[model samples]
Target: MKKRFLGYPNWWGEMPMAVYTFIEKHDWEGRTIVPFCTHEGSGLSGTERRIQSACTGAKVLKGLAVRGSAAQHEQESVRKSVSSWLEKLHL
Candidate 1:
């Protein structure tokens, strides 16, 4: 598997406004927002909270915490979890 690391600019720290703007701009109300994260050790690491606070109108679901190193081997588990979430949300 090929791994790609996405590096954002320093302004990424100011991303909450961008996130809010995107949600409003896209008119994504009544949609479930699943915020998943890959971390070296921290797991979900408050990303879900951030999304919840930023996207006030959307339903922020519990996030999946995947270790970065294990992502390559966790495809099946990830697929199953995502499928289950989709079924539960009926989306």
Candidate 2:
């Protein structure tokens, strides 16, 4: 027997196909899709746009960008933002 990685080992490399499938699957879901991305410096990196194109019927909200290192300290901000967005969207 050989050792094999069950999940995608190179997620970034497969992101395009993954995004396409995600978009196709969620296109008809009548809910807002909010993305929160943690990056070293690149921020959301246009992921919101990609998600918007993928999720046709859902309104993709402006995503939050938090430094991966700073995520622990950003708990309050994340909570507040999500709460505000949910309230605004009435979701």
- Cα-lDDT of candidate 2: 0.55
Runs in model 1 deviating more than 4 A are 1-28, 73-91
Q: Write the per-residue lDDT of candidate 1 for residues 1-91, one digit (tens) a residue.
A: 1211211111322234554566456533565676655556666656666666665566777656655556678888877876786577455
Positional deviation of residue 90's Cα in model 1 after best superposition, in angstroms: 6.6
- Residue range 14-76, candidate 2, lDDT tens digits: 234664665575434576665665566676666767666666566666655656556578788
Candidate 2 Cα outliers beyond 4 Å, as residue runs: 1-23, 72-91
Local distance difference test, per candidate?
0.55, 0.55
Looking at model 2, the pairs that clash are none
Measured against the true structure, the TM-scores of the candidates, in listed sequence, are 0.55, 0.55
Q: Which residue window of length 10 is worst by lDDT in model 1? A: 1-10
